[model samples]
Target: MKIRVHVSLKPGVLDPQGRAVHHALEGLGFEGVEDVRVGRSIELDVADNTSDAALTDMCEKLLANTVIENYRIEKVG
Candidate 1:
């Protein structure tokens, strides 16, 4: 099975990388970009029988920092 994990900073957290990209876009003449938030996508190939609970455990344990970030697990195949 194919899986995807989308990790992003939780609301109210400052995103310096995202801010830099937003500033760069404005400098390059891209208008109306009010804000930006950077996130990561992780893809994995696991056994077809892998359960959702196992995937959630992975995210909670190591894939994402639950204190400052949130993660969504997606089954791609």
Candidate 2:
């Protein structure tokens, strides 16, 4: 099975990297960008029998910080 994990910073947390990208875009004459928030996506291939609970555990334990970030899981195949 294929799985995907989307990880992002929680609201109210400052995203310095995202801000840097936004600034760079503006400098490059790319306007109209109101705001920018950066995140990451993780893809995994695992046994078909892998339980959702196990995936959640993986996210909670290692994939996501859980303190300043949130994660969403999708079973791709």
Which lDDT values do the candidates have, in the order given?
0.97, 0.97
What lDDT is obtained when candidate 1 is compared to the true structure?
0.97
List ranges where model 1 is wrong by over 4 Å: none
What's the true lDDT of residue 24 in model 1?
100
Candidate 1, residues 1-77: lDDT per residue as tens digits?
99999999999999999999999999999999999999999999999998889999999999999999999998888
Candidate 2: global Cα-lDDT?
Answer: 0.97
lDDT of 2 by residue, 1-77 (tens): 99999999999999999999999999999989999999999999999999999999999999999999999999887
Kindly report which residue pairs in candidate 1 clash with one another: none
Clash count of each predicted structure: 0, 0
